[model samples]
Target: MMRFAVLGSGSGGNAAVVECGGLRLMIDAGLSAKQLSARLQSVGIDPKSLDGILLTHEHGDHVRGLKVFLKQNPIPVYTTPATARVVRETGIDGGTWKFFEAGQAFTLGGISVETFAIQHDAVDPVGFVLGDQSRRLGFLSDAGFVTRSMTERLRGLAGLFVEANYDEGLLEADTKRPWSIKQRISSRHGHLSNTQVTELIREISHPALGRVVLGHLSSDCNTPDIILNRLRACLGELGHGHVGLHCAGQHEPSDWFDF
Candidate 1:
């Protein structure tokens, strides 16, 4: 069986630890090494045992503390060529880096992982589909639009983590943010709104879909209740209200789910 947990999930920072078989893997290290260690300890995982860090993009919120964190433990970092160029330019340590295509399948820590392109501002951004021999989990975030490619690649998962970043009504009414900021969030490379998320959920909902986690929310444009109630209402209407829904918190991690 494989287990996963969110160390923290949001634009403030993000990280997830996945344990499968005898391997321990990290999805991203948006937090500092110290913070990452503490978060891992909170879930009873030792930072020293991390085998790798799989990067989704080169955004600061996703790679800020990477250098310091890899300094001591030196886990292999996997990313695309475009992301590696920026990581090098940033003077991040290269000793633990490896390069891979953003839309190919690969192995890390003895488990299989597949990467698929997602719409984002970075040179090459992606969402991940990871699994062991028995089960699969999909992680999709930071994408502005969900392409047909996304729906096809993310099918048939035991666990799913996707962004439900904002409410359309909230985003439209918030004049406090500049026009450009709002436009970007509403753009093709921006985040997904609550409706887009549930819409995508309907497209991907299958019998094998076991757990769903909503993550990478905008602190200004969304609240847990707003997103939750919307999903609950939709799922209840669809007669699948019993599905487990987890809302990621900005200040703390969420509980681990086993599959």
Candidate 2:
């Protein structure tokens, strides 16, 4: 069985674990090492047991804890050269780092991983499709728009983790944020809106897709109800209403999703 747990998600931080057979991979380490250890323990995962860490980008919210975590664990970190250089510039060190180009496929611990570039305000952002013979898992977040290649690669997955960052109306109505910040949030290199998530879900809907986990929600601009309602409507229209739906929270690890 292949299973995953979102350790945390949001603007504050993001991380997740994907496990199959005896291999365990941490998708990102965004929180402090202490906080990350506690979250992993909450899910009965030992931090010392992690096999590797795969980074998506160089944004602080996605890679803040990476150096600290690597210092303690000394595990291999896989990412693009651009992101690795950014990490090195941050003055944190101690890990075996491996570089991979976007759109390349590689194998780690018998599982196949395919990487694809994503549009984001970061150096060389990418998403992943991981598979182990029978089941496939697609993970994409921090992307401004869903590209044609992303949709094509994500089809026919057993599970998916995609970002539903905000509701456009809510974001636009929020008076707390400055216009510049608001513009950035709604920009082509920012985050995905709820409507965009719905379109992506509809595009990737298939009978074999068992579950969809939404993450990276904006605390002020989005709510679980708003995102879920929109996604539910789209899934119903696409005849995929039976698929399970889940939301990854910022404060705690989500329940394990098994495939």
Candidate 3:
């Protein structure tokens, strides 16, 4: 059996826990150490019990809490060499480093993890497809665009935790961010728009896909209602309305999902 939960997700921070075969792994430590521990316990997960941390990139919203968190619960931190070097330079040098080349498969506590490069502005960003004997889950967040290879790797998963960062119409209509920032966000190396992610879901949807939790939403530009309505409709059109659709938030954790 495999289970997971998104502790919180948004522009402020992003974090999640995945457990299988009696081993627990944290996907990121973007929240403050205090909050991370509290939230973990809130979900019945003891902070110190994590087997390791899998890092996607070195962006602040994805790694700010890592330094303090590891100080309290030291464990192996896995990532690409470039990502590790960039994160270490930022003074988050507490945990033991474990390196994996992109597009390779590695094993952690009997779980097989397939890593693929992601198109994001951060250095050496990546996504993962983790699987055991009977289940697989894909984690793909903070990506600008989807690739053919990514879709191929993520197909037929039991669950997916992906980013639906912004809506094109809302982003263009918002005046808070400067034009430059907007351009960057919609660029090939920033974050995925709602349309982009929805298309990704369309391509990867299969009989075995049981759940999808949307993460890393733009606070100013995206809302749960909008994305959920869009995704729910898309899933219905694909004859996948039975698939569970969830949204993770910045201030609280999502319900645990088991597969």
Candidate 4:
């Protein structure tokens, strides 16, 4: 069995735990060490029990707690060489760092992980698909737009944790953020919009896709009801109403989902 939980997801911090049998890996370490530990414990997992940490990029929202977490746990950190270099430039050194190139597959214990390049402003950002022998989980967050290669790579997964960063209309109408920031959010190198996410879901839909979790929501411009309703409407039109849907929150961890 494969089980996973999003410790937290949003602009403040983002992290998730993916476990298969005795292997448990963390996807990011955005929260502080203390907060990460508390969240892990809430999910009945000891922080020290993780096999390793896989990074999606060097962005602070994805790696803020990495240095402190490594100081306490000292496990291997897997990421692209470019991201690793930037991470070191940020004064986060030490720990076992293993660099992997995009479009390659690596094995960690009983699980297999495949990395693919993603469109993001950060240095060499990527997405990951992890699986044991029987089940696969696709994770794609912080990407600006979905590509043909990404859709091909993510097809037919048992579970998917994808970004639904913001609603285009809501974001464009919001006056709190500056125009430049809004432009960046909607740019090719920025986060994926709700419509983009819906398009991705439609393109990647498969019979084996059992679960879909909307992640990395904008706390100010997006709401759970809007995202959920939009996704449901899209999937329903495509005859995928049977697929289980969940949303990852910014402040709290989501329930453990088993595949």
Candidate 5:
């Protein structure tokens, strides 16, 4: 059996946990140490019992709490060499480092995790597909666009956690960001818009895919209702209306999704 929970998700922070075969692993520790510990407890997991932490990139929103959290718990941190270098430059060196290259497959405890490159501004950003024989879970956030390799690697997932960062119309109408920032946001190496996320979901969805949790939303430019409606409609059009859809928010943890 595979069960997971998104502790929180958005530009403010991002984190999630995956449990399978008695092994518990945290995908990121972007929340404060206190929130991370409390959210883990909320999900009935002890922070100290975590087998490891897998990092997708070196961005602050994905790794802000790693140093302090690992200092208290002392778990191993896994990521690519390039990403580790960038994170180390930020003075975060509390956990033991386990480096793996992009497009590599590795085993931690009983789960098999496969990594692939993703389009993001950060150095060596990657997405993960973890599973055993029974079920697979795909995690992809901070992605600018979906790559061919990503689509191929993320197939056959029981659950998918992906980014839907912004809605094009809302982003364009927003008054806060200037033209340059808006350009950066909609760039190829920035973040995935709602339309792009919907396209990605349509390309990789399968009948066995049970749940889709959208994350990394723009607090200022995106609304849950908007993206949820778009995703629901897309799935329905594809004859996959049975798929479960949930949007993860920054301020609170989401309910555990079991497969």
Candidate 6:
């Protein structure tokens, strides 16, 4: 069986755990090792039992705590050449770095992970698709748009952590965030809005999808209801049913899922 859980999600920090059998992969290390350890503990995971860390990018809310994690834990860290170099230059400890080219498949802790490019502002930003025996999970939260290639690579996911960072209408009409900042969030290289994500879900909606965790939400621009409503409306059209929709908070980890 494969299981996964988000330690936390949002602009402040983001981390998630994916475990199969005795192998567990920490999807990101945005928080300090201490904070990450505590979050894992709350989810019944031992910090010392971590197998490795897989980074999506070098954003502060995604790779900020990598240095502390590597220095204190002595676990391996995996990322693309661009991400790994930036992390090291930014004072992240990557002495045990293993490079993974986007589109390449790698095996860690008895699970196979494949990386795919995501259209973000960072150099070579990517998301992961992890597979065990008969199960697969996709972890992607910071892409501006989804491509046909991305869709092809993401087929048959048991769980998904796609982004619904903001609601376009609320963000455009009500939010008081500066115009420049607003433009950035609405840009093609920025975060995905609820409508955009809803559209993507509709396009990529698959029956095998078990859980849909709407993560990396903006505290200022989005709410649970906004994301949930859009999700329900979109999936409902495709006749998708009973897929668990979860909203992860800044400090609160989500409930565990065993698939």
Error of 6 at 197 (Å): 1.1
Candidate 1 residue lDDT tens string, 1-259: 8888998888888898888867888888888778888989999988888888888888887887788888877788888989888876898865477788878898866689899999988889988888887899899978899999899998888889888998999999887899999999889998899988989888877766778899998888898899888888877777777668899887787999887
Candidate 2 lDDT tens digits, 1-259: 8999999999999999999867899998888888888999999999999999999998899888988788888999999999899988998778999989988999997789999999989989999999889999999989988889889999989999999998999999999999999888888889999988888889888888899999999999999999898888888988888889998999999999999
Clashing pairs for predicted structure model 3, backbone only: none
Candidate 2 versus the native: TM-score? 0.98
TM-score of each: 0.96, 0.98, 0.98, 0.98, 0.98, 0.96
Local distance difference test values of all predictions, in order: 0.86, 0.91, 0.92, 0.92, 0.93, 0.84
Error of 1 at 127 (Å): 0.9
**Candidate 4 — worst ten consecutive residues by lDDT sum?**
201-210
Q: Write the per-residue lDDT of candidate 4 for residues 67-167, one digit (tens) a residue.
A: 98999999999998999999989888879999899888999888999999999999899999999888899999899988899999998899999989999
Residue 239 C-alpha lDDT in model 6: 88
**Candidate 5 stretches greater than 4 Å from native:** none
Clashes of each: 0, 0, 0, 0, 0, 1
> Sorted on lDDT, highest at the top, how do the candidates line up?
5, 3, 4, 2, 1, 6
Instruction: Give lDDT tens digits, candidate 5, residues 1-259.
Output: 8999999999889999999877899998889888999999998999999999999998898899988998999999999999999998999877899999999999987899999999989999999998998899999989888888888898899999999999999999999999999998899889999999999899989899999999999999999999999999999999999999999989989999999
Worst 10 residues of 3 by lDDT: 86-95
Q: In terms of lDDT, which candidate is stronger, 1 or 4?
A: 4
lDDT of 4: 0.92
Pairs clashing within candidate 5: none
Model 2 Cα displacement at 75 (Å)? Answer: 0.4
